[model samples]
Target: MTKPKTQEPVITSTSELPTSEAKWVTLRKVNYTDQTGAARTWEVASRKTRAKSAGVDAVAMGNVILHPARAPATVVVIQYRPPLDAYTVEWPAGLIDEGESAEDAAVREFKEEIGYDCEVTSVSPVQAADPGMSDANMKLVMVEVKLGEEDGEELPVQRLEDGEHIQRVVVPLTELYQRLVEWSEGERKIVAAKLFHFAAGMEFARKEGKKYGL
Candidate 1:
């Protein structure tokens, strides 16, 4: 008699996986059938805030702040990211509060992280942070601010949260791309995608004499 072969289990749906307790984040495992209908399993890391939301998860916001001065400049922040165990250079960003819009969240984060009260000039469509791994989304807001002697006001002070430690870095508009390139080659440094995209648009606009949506 010939020996019989065992059939593999087919996964038709996803479910949450058991994980250790964490305050800000959680992990889940999903099971599904791929395009070829093969059973597959994947793990996802999600923000606890989104998981705990009553209805739909709130979108996050980031600001691309431009300071109009004798020499045009843009603002970014350097802060420690626990996951990477390194400092990340990113735009001012935060999650939208329950009753706030993306523009409102952008303004609040700008004040909290960079200490600047800026006028929001434009807001971009929502973009996924990482579709393959996370469901996080954020809108990039363009803010025009007058800094230094241009606005006739003193330097703004950061209003960071209790556990936050952020440092402001200003890059000259002309050198924004160059600085990004340098940072890309540096050690233990990660640049936010939104910042890179915004800077690239600005650079393109400068070369082509076309406005890239501010």
Candidate 2:
């Protein structure tokens, strides 16, 4: 069967709205007294879908793909971000369902986005997604996926939703940071901050290890 070509999403127009009219995310003015005793009001955006059971708005998967003879790799997804009106390279992520846990959300999102089942290895504490701009928070869930020799070169089919046109890129662990940087420059793509920070941290640790002979 021939698959239908995906169309690139474009913003036809943009407009401003009062906070009260927002559905998915709402803006708020936080009033508080500063350390110096001056009153302050800060504007912030908050997600209306934050699940109390999940204790977070979202979960991003830090997936490590293990192969018998190849270097370990990770999956990064590229998709159009409407707010930015640009394609973004980001960790496979999704909102946590009302009744789901972080680990479950990680596994489900990884499968839906990357087409690989993963084992949740660790879950980071809830972290701010954009502290200065929004009150949205997410947890980084580290997961591992093992691939058989036959599956090494084949890309699995993604189980994405109708409007989700995601392209998955498998990147070797050692080359991730450089690869992301190259993608950002060469393709003029937006890289998600959390994903960039993760790659940068790994690269930093690797360089430090070599420097100290660890």
Candidate 3:
């Protein structure tokens, strides 16, 4: 089969966004008190699409797809992130629709972005996404996808929405950290903070475990 061609998106122009016209995000001048009771003000960018029923803004799926004949692997998404004007290596994630639970969002996003049906194994507590910059918070939902021998190694076709151009890469869990590092350097792609941290943490634990004979 032939592969489809893709081009890097071009930027036509840029301008400051007016707060009144902003739909997805907004700028805020926050006021607060420090540890010493000192008054302070800081500029911050905030998301305007957080659903009140969801509580948290989004969910990043920590996917583990197990094949009967092969080692367990995870799928990561490579998509163009306009803010950086470059592609990013990130977990399959998406905003929780109104009244949608984190688990449902994770499952839906995984199917849409990676074309896999997964079962939610666990869900993390609400955690900050970028505390220093935005008030965005998210949950890390651990999901497992079981593949039968008949399924083969090929991933299913993605069901992405319009305007979405994402590439999915499946990597063994043991090689995930190294792969992310190589992709970041070789492809000159930005690594999303949450994804990078998760990979780094796994690598760190593996190294410590070996050193401690764990």
Candidate 4:
């Protein structure tokens, strides 16, 4: 009797990876008065991805794609995060370029990061990412993609930036929760809050036999 081979896990532990010393973020202090008229100074960090015309933190966009034609799956990316000294599992996301809309940013980032051209279905309102710490805001965009039914499908070409190490992972929607659980138990951890909530919601909807319109 022959044994069947199992597929390797999509997530990988990269805690030992080294990061570049290039300065990608900057910190500054701002003094503001509160409702009680007390003046206080707060430190804030800013990313170089922000556009010059932006007053607040630059607009960022994230995509949640569902492929209905092929094997049911969602697009995700695993990339090294220097701050945590670990690789993070997150959706394809990027900062909106000058003269670009949030929807366009999401579409462009999806292709650049995951190498798939997706059709934007919906865009959410601006949501804060740690208002108490950073002024960064993101608009979650939903897109629908189709991956053909084939064993070992051809991987798409990525257009990553210099110093970026992103690995595209096509996660089956049916096994998202299980994968998350496995990650939690394994060495690598899922630190993206949006990704966690999205997976949880999807699993809940699946259990309740409910269709997520988004």
What would the TM-scores of all predictions be? 0.72, 0.93, 0.93, 0.72
Inter-residue clash pairs, candidate 1: none
TM-score-wise, the better of 1 and 2 is 2
Candidate 1 ranges with C-alpha deviation above 4 Å: 1-18, 33-39, 51-69, 147-154, 204-214
lDDT of 3 by residue, 1-214 (tens): 7856777787778899899999999999999999999999998988999989988999999999898889889999998888888899999999999989999999999999999889999999999988898898999999999998899878899998988999898899999999988888955498898999999989989989788776
On the 0 to 100 scale, the lDDT of residue 167 in model 3 is 86
Write model 1 residue lDDT over 133-172, tens digit each, in one string.
9767666677777555456334478887876877678767
Query: How far off is residue 141 in model 2, in Å?
Result: 0.3
Q: How close is candidate 4 to the true structure, as a TM-score?
A: 0.72
Tens digits of per-residue lDDT, candidate 2, 1-214, equal 9988767677899999777888899988899999999999999989999888878999999889999989999989988899888889999999999999999999898988888889999999989988999999999999999888877567788898987889888889989999989888955479999999988888888888788776
Candidate 1, residue 61: the lDDT equals 35
For residue 39, give model 3's deviation from the true position in Å: 2.0
* Minimal lDDT window, size 10, model 3: 1-10
